[model samples]
Target: MSLEVTVVQACLRSGRGGSRTAVVEDGDLSDAARRTVPGAVGASQAVFIAAQDPAAVRLRFFTSTGELPACGHGTVAALAVLAQRSGNDRYDGVLHSTTRSLPGHAIGNAGHYSAAFEPGPIDLRAATIEEADPILSALRVSAEVAGCHVASVGRPRLLVELADRQTLANLAPDMPTLQAVTDRLDLLGCYVYVTPSSDGHTVARMFAPSIGVPEDIANANSTACAAAHLSTRGHSKLQVDMGDSLGQPATMTATVTGSPGTPIVEVGGTATISGRHHLD
Candidate 1:
């Protein structure tokens, strides 16, 4: 048996840099075969479209190590592929994953594509001092932090705020300890960021060694979490800049509407098809 995989760069910064994702449209793979796609293609994550309908699409996400409940950038990559294949400039419908469903849409024309989705249920709360200590220590910084909180939009991620971009740039986390701390706290990863700049652009980085991705070039869900965290303090719309640390600089936008505590979060970014491959 053979499968076709489309590689896409999602959440591109100026149509140039983004995270590499593998998208498989075929739904005939066994669970065992599906798990091998990410590793085979050297992609951090893979999205499988199990079913597609006029009104809804069912998707499954996987990393080399295990299945993921949800994946933001992967979702974007999948939708962009769908939009391009359909020969439509815009595509909109519900997106169903194993854990939940949400409305999503994609738009494309002339070789450019972008997608967005609402990840249901947003949660944010300050981390207890005890919890913050280990995380900060693992990150190897102190006193330069402005705030720290645990935020989630489906999966929990620790949101750490630094005082300036230099601190963010100089981050050299203890990967082993950070992985241990995230595992202990039941966190997907830690998202450390500096506040928005004069132009409302938030620069950030995501680390999740526990999941085999020591550093993520682009993390849409974490950006959504950052939006939710900042919404509570009055900033509702902003763009997050990530991946520069890895030299694959990517960008994603998060918009928080409705209200502060109960805000609705939507994340969007553009993607481009980089290549394709056949696997057996």
Candidate 2:
């Protein structure tokens, strides 16, 4: 069998600092393209690629494992790339990502271009008691896993609210269990969130070490929607402090205004394009 993939290596230096993504797709791509594409960079490296058939720009996440729904940093990178690729149109409105969220789809907003992604609802029910212990062990979180919930930001992730910031910061989870939880619950991974009085709203840090991420994530757009829902319900805005504690800290902001269903979930930050590479 002959296999081919077209990959685009996109760079984004924004809220989360910087990430190099190599997007790959088969069917009309050169051999060189597949060699340097995102996931091909390393084992399990996360790459954001667009699956276009009818010329429809639908974004898909190509992790070391398979395709994922939504990816915040990748989407941001993609938005900027899409704007440049479209050549004519500017994605000013909320353009949808390929992934599905609980509410509908994940939405990304760029001044020149934006994306909308339909993610599953913010569901705490999908998380099971059987999976908690294994997940906590995977993250190396030794704290008491009391408040555990599941949310479908863009891709489904297990949200575990720790006792406090101190506990949240110090974690060294077991990888097998981490992978096990997602395999069992069939979630994206786990995002450890907490409420630090200094911030007022709940502060969360996400990690999918099992799926390929090793440290704190800079900005999670998908998580922003879930936080928005939680914020609206809790009457508090979600102040997501991601990628910090691990040192390179970044923040994502989402407000709780407008109607419940079609409510607008906006995440704000600066995205800088350090560089771009052509695949073969």
| Per-model TM against the reference | 0.95, 0.69
lDDT of each: 0.86, 0.51
Per-prediction backbone clash count = 0, 33
TM-score of 2: 0.69
Residue lDDT tens for model 1, 67-111: 888899998888888788778899787888888886888898755
Per lDDT, the best of the predicted structures is 1
lDDT of 2 by residue, 1-280 (tens): 1333322222222434334444333345443433335444432334444446424455555555445556665655555555555454444324445644212122233323333232334443435667666777678876676566666665566777676877876776666667666777677777777743444445566667555665535545545645654654554455566655554555555555556654555554334333444333
The candidate that wins on TM-score is: 1
Error of 1 at 4 (Å): 0.4
lDDT for residue 152 in candidate 2, whole number 0-100: 63
State the RMSD for candidate 1.
Answer: 1.5
